[model samples]
Target: MIASFPYLIVGLLFLFGLYAVVFERNLIKIAIGISVIEAATNMFLIVLGYRTGGRIPVFTLAGESKVLVLPTPQALTLTAIVIGMATTALMLSLIMVLYRHYGTLDVREIRRLRG
Candidate 1:
């Protein structure tokens, strides 16, 4: 049970983020939800590449052989984190612009203004 704790937390984080995205009416809340989802995904990727007693992928002595955790997932997670940060910043900027025009951060008000 303890071994699966990380997976469980990740699942909950994803679900909470999805819930916020679907139910929250505030633009900032939606942006936060997106960030949460991205974080959960990154965590899942890192966990997938984790191994007990694993070593970094590097050339060692001729007589040394050890389990090496895959580095691809870590690389992918780093890229995803950078992209997510950019996306969150873009979303917040758009939200600010919308608030300036609509005078509120409520999604319903913005949608009504669109029509």
Candidate 2:
């Protein structure tokens, strides 16, 4: 039970972010919500990579007796963070363009342009 608590929290946070993304009316809020979800998932992955009472993955840090922290998730998290940043940058750019064209940030209001 104790072992899974961290994962549970991460999942819940992800779900909450997902709910906010789908339920929000503002485009900015939706973007933020997605970012939140991504962050939570990243954190979950990183935590999963970590072992019980593990030390840093660095070889110089420990004389090989201590268990090393899993590097895969840390690498993955770095990649994920980069991807998230790029996505946010793109989304914000699009939002700016959208604002320039429509003068509003509301997703519902932008639908009139669809027709």
Candidate 3:
């Protein structure tokens, strides 16, 4: 039970983000929710790669440790962070454009104004 605490946190974080995305009416809030989901994913990747008494996977910098944590998840998490930043930026930009066009941040209002 204690060993699985991190996984439990990840599940909770994902659920919170999903709730915000589904129930929030404000564009900014929805964008923030998406970011939270991305964060949860990044954290999950890191947690998945963590090992007790394991050293970093850098051969040149690592000491004499037989057990090394996998580096692939870390690399993938870094890539996801970069991509998530770009995606969030794009989402915010679009939200700004919508606000300028509709004069409101509410998703329902924007939809109504579209027609």
Candidate 4:
């Protein structure tokens, strides 16, 4: 029962993020929503590593052993970080160019290349 709670929370986060992305009018909000969803997915991955009787992940030079919480999620989170950074930078750069030309940040106002 305890383990199921995290999954439920993660699911709710995913739903909220979905709603934010689909309903938000501002581009920035959409980006933030995507980020939230990504983070929730990452959390779910991390939670998958927990065990009922698992020990700590710390290791000593003397050969003391422990259960690793899960390195895959941590690695994936790093990847997500890089992706999120790149996406945000690209989005902001695009927004800046739009603002410079249109004198506004509203996505609806920038209609130069629309066929």
Q: In terms of TM-score, which candidate is strongest?
A: 3
C-alpha displacement of 15 in model 2, angstroms?
A: 0.9
Best-to-worst TM-score order: 3, 1, 2, 4
Candidate 2 positional error at 6, Å: 1.0
lDDT of each: 0.92, 0.90, 0.94, 0.74
lDDT of 1 by residue, 15-56 (tens): 999999999999999999999999999999999999888887
- TM-scores of the candidates are 0.92, 0.89, 0.94, 0.74
lDDT of each residue in 1-115, candidate 4, tens digit only: 8769999999999999999889876777777788789878877877776666555455443244544555566678778778878877887788677667778755565654444
- Candidate 2 Cα outliers beyond 4 Å, as residue runs: 60-65
Judge candidate 4 at residue 84 and give its lDDT: 76
**lDDT for each residue of candidate 3 in 35-90, tens digit (9 for 90 to 100):** 99999999999999999988888766666656789899999999999999999999
Model 4: how far residue 77 lies from native, Å: 1.8
Error of 3 at 74 (Å): 0.3
Off by over 4 Å in 4: 56-67, 111-115
